[model samples]
Target: MKDFLPVLKILLRFVIVYIVLVLLYQFYLNEYENDVVDPFTRWVAQQVAFLQSIFGFPTVLVDSLKLHSILFQTEGRFTTRMVEGCNVISVVILFSAFVFAFYKGAKTFLYVLAGLVILHILNVLRIVMLNIIFIKYPQYERVGHDYIFPAIVYGGVVVLWLIWIQFFALKKTDKS
Candidate 1:
């Protein structure tokens, strides 16, 4: 019983944070009129188009509130609609929950903030890359979007967690 107490505490923290975030997200989604998620989706689409422009791909970002995503059209050829999933909010919540669960100190908060920013940037890059790849090789769209891109972003989060544990979390444990 004693041995499981620490694990239970960590799980309780994680669950509480996760539940709160999920509820907040749900509330945001339920705001159908003058929805907040649309603007975020638009921002992501705009950012993605900007990234595509840097590579000289001639991109267009179409804002469609009804569609609930930003339509990314490149050279009037290939189009990739970036929805809420592409925004990285869910991943942010998951990462935050885990960090809160194993939180050590102010350092941990800083790490979580940095990680969220990095993850958001990576997600944007992933969308841009996927659109480019889809335009160039339409056949590989499913594999790139479904597997390769997620592997990279999620794999990055896993690496960040490992670094936190090794450099920060463990030090606190050792000291205590």
Candidate 2:
């Protein structure tokens, strides 16, 4: 029982935080009625479209009814859709839960804030990259979107977690 205490604490904290954040997310979703683009999703689509335009690709983001997404279309054809999940809130929740559970000091807040910003930028870039890839090679859509791209985003979260543990969490744990 004593040996399991540390693991138990981390698990409990993670579960509690996850539940709370998910509940809040549910409330947010409820505020936007059916067949509507929530602000976050719309923002992500806008960011992707902006990037595409910057890269010399004419893009338009439109609220999609049938798919419940902010679809990004290039060359007057649908390229990809920025749905709720593409906003990366779920990944941020997981990252936050882990870091908060093992937080050491004031730096914990800063680390989480910086991590979220980086994660958001990475997510936007990921979408843009996927859009270009899929448009150029339509056959690779499944492999890129489902496998390669997700690995990059989640892999970034893992890297941030490792950095936190090494620089902050582990040092504090050793001192205590």
- Pairs in clash, predicted candidate 2: none
* C-alpha TM-score for every candidate: 0.91, 0.93
The total of clashing pairs for model 2 equals 0
Position 135, candidate 2: lDDT: 84
Candidate 1 lDDT? 0.83
Angstrom error of the Cα, residue 63, model 2: value is 1.3
Q: Which candidate has the highest lDDT of all?
A: 2
* TM-score, predicted candidate 2 vs. hidden true structure: 0.93
Candidate 1 residue-wise lDDT, 1-176, digit = tens: 99999999999999999999999987876775455245566677788899899998889876667876667878886478877878888988898898889878798789999998898899889988898888888899999989999987898789888887788766655446
- Per-prediction tally of clashes: 0, 0
Model 1 stretches astray by more than 4 angstroms: 32-37, 172-176
lDDT of each: 0.83, 0.88
